[model samples]
Target: MELFEGRPADCSGRQEREVRVYDLLDRLGIAYQRTDHVPAGTMEDCDRIDAVLEVTICKNLFLCNRQKTAFYLLMMPGNKAFRTKDLAAQLGVARLSFGTPEDMLRLLDVTPGSVSVMGLMNDRDNQVQLVIDRDVLKGERIGCHPCLNTSSLRFATSDLLEKVLPAMGHSPILVNL
Candidate 1:
């Protein structure tokens, strides 16, 4: 895959969700690099893309409380081992589980295998809390799926935290893990 600056000139055949991500970034005046590839669901599939982007693509998890009333979007180092018990303690919440595909779609406008911070744009209700790893914020740049597993995007970490998240009405709670 090759990286191109900003939105694709020809977005004609792209999924609407993907297109919306690009549109939001452009509208926010945030520059990004993009590459198209086969849908990536595993780290092995992402290694090549990660190499090209020169940043570890954060692993995004869609999680919810036992009642499913509170939802969270977590961005963490792809290599970091995740332990629900650990995260639950940090967030002061009861047991958390992977959100269902149905809630993922309803709130984020994204299906399984394609969760990212970009999806927060669709959560106008601010129902989903953004939880990001402190390590992720330390990176100068971050790579992530553009609400579609078939494509990936790289953007300045500052733009995401300072501009994008605020615009999306998401104030991330930084976690060390």
Candidate 2:
């Protein structure tokens, strides 16, 4: 395993989820860079990881409507402010709140800071709708934790939106933020 410092350190015994993500990328022929880091579960932690990875790690928020019948996993630029009202209006759902850790684990198979677009791979039933901010779509490359917060990965934005999602049978809703 390579540390975020760009040095090839041994990630040999850890990172099962990240390994699966890399395998998925390899199978899809999507190029990416992986950076292993200390486990982080907050925005501050992500900032530290970003310094090493040299690209912004997107903020992934797992949300559910009041009824919990509708779930959304939203990805956006880390610096952007999230306005719940705007999102609710655009999505035509009632107010959305951060999902509980248990819900995240059960629905996306992810813990708190590890929430990511790759988690959609486990969303076989398509229960959680994926939403991406417009700014995130314009980036040349996007960074995300591979299904865990201890490591981050980068890939071309086009590959992620066009190839990987389609392969995973997920069609993301693009929302202008």
**Best candidate, TM-score-wise?**
1
For each candidate in the order shown, give its overall lDDT on alpha carbons: 0.93, 0.83
C-alpha RMSD of candidate 2: 2.6
Query: Tens-digit lDDT track for model 2 on 15-118?
Result: 56666777788799887777767788667878877776667888899999998888899999999999999999899987899999998988878898789999
Writing each residue's lDDT as its tens digit, candidate 1 over 18-103 gives 99998899999998999888889777889989988898999999999999999999999999999999899999998999999999
Runs of candidate 1 exceeding 4 Å displacement: none
Model 2 residue 21 CA deviation (Å) reads 1.2
Enumerate clash totals for all models, in the order shown.
0, 1
Tell me the TM-score of each prediction against the true structure.
Answer: 0.98, 0.89
Q: Which ten residues in a row have the lowest lDDT in candidate 1?
A: 36-45
